[model samples]
Target: MINKKNQETLSHHLQKLEDISPKQLNKDQKDLIKKMLELLFNDPNTTTLEFENAYRVLIQRVKVGFTFDAAPSEAKNTISLLVKDEEKSFVNDPLKPHNQLIIGENYDALKNLLVIEGERESKVLTLFTM
Candidate 1:
């Protein structure tokens, strides 16, 4: 069981983490700090030494995760358009919009589909063949 003082310290650190501006830290940094705070908050066995180490890592901006060339780049929110290829299309209807095949990461595609299809009056049928 966590002592009352430790609980208060955890609460104070969590509040401090939350108070940090989004612009000041990249998404990965924010995620790392948030996860660390969550672990500290949820774990009853968390020690003062662990908390000190975590804070030291955060304050010093020590490299934690795998570094890549794209790590520094911000993720872009983009809407992907599904356009039908006439040459490869087996069937075509003049009255209806052409059926499209979207090839890319599913998460971003789902987000785009949700945004675009949500605007339509009719329900959209989504199929994931893969």
Candidate 2:
């Protein structure tokens, strides 16, 4: 079973992997791979073979029976501010605010936002997250 920390780590790795392209080398992907290697072997000076082996091991580990059980929900056309479990005491724009506070797992919230936004006729100009 995947713990919360492992789930968060895997989500981070998945995000990094999704940003990589086949046509060019990505610095983020390289850094992520190096970090993975460092975590696995406590050594960043990994050879190509070692990197490949580590990648294979990661693939095998990821092939488990894990699934995204969160269902997408509808949202209004407003600026979304995603936050974790912690409650924020202050608001920058309390008056004339068009912000929607989404509190939960960021990955799932993003997915749900995408789903909601996809159904709208108007296109979203920008998505800012912290």
Candidate 3:
């Protein structure tokens, strides 16, 4: 089961990982990650990432699950985003502005989905920084 603290850590990792370009993942690390993703995809009953070790696994799973937008015709013209910060105090926080990082493990599952959209730059990633 995914505990609370562990969940937060995962979010942090995902945020950090986003900054690192795919080219940086050396041959070995990339290969291992690829294998891990394959294993996870082959088995849907795999355990979801709830911590550091699981971070790599979770990324792999998300990437495989979503078909990133590479090239498109005139029809598919939508941009997507990967990471997002859904500030709970959207209408609240009268003192502070609306921009805030919603980095917490509890948001891992949702963030993963967003990242895929980001790769494609789909309409979903077009978040307004209010």
Candidate 4:
């Protein structure tokens, strides 16, 4: 959650970030940029201390969630993938240990993967298509 004041500050910070080149940022600024990104992406595990530290130079206010109109739902064909209790490897290459094939509900899998990536601070480029 982000208070209105902090949200405005974050908007300003985003504009500032856009105005400056990545190379121009100092170490502290670079770290702040990362923290801002984490917050914007809704990193679920972000601690209160981390949030406070990130916004310390900005405004202090009780955080609140924003409200918006719900998006319209679409009707589409659905498919299911079956998985066994035991893990099975579809591909096994010692040279490509990081390569994996995830078979599950796409949305849930994507969310879980994003959480893992956030925790590890990993740079993972994912491409998805229907």
Give residue 114's error in model 4 in angstroms. 53
Model 4 residue pairs with clashes: none
TM-score of 3: 0.23
After the best TM-score superposition of candidate 2, give how far the Cα of residue 7 lies from its true spot, in angstroms: 28
Write model 2 residue lDDT over 29-82, tens digit each, in one string.
Answer: 456665675465434464445645776665453346354556866555655554
Residues 1-130 of candidate 3: C-alpha lDDT, one tens digit per residue: 4455544554555455555556555455545654554454345465544233565554564455544556644324443444446863235567887656666654545555666746567553555332
Estimate, for each residue in 1-130, the C-alpha lDDT of model 1 and write its tens digit: 6678777887777676667655555667767887877687567676777876777677455334433453554357645687657887665678887876767757665776677678552443333322
Estimate the lDDT of model 4: 0.53
Clashes of each: 0, 0, 13, 0
Worst 10 residues of 1 by lDDT: 121-130
TM-score of every candidate? 0.38, 0.24, 0.23, 0.24
Which prediction has the highest lDDT against the true structure?
1
Worst lDDT 10-window in candidate 4: 58-67
Q: Who is ahead in lDDT, 1 or 4?
A: 1
Q: In candidate 2, which residue pairs clash?
A: none
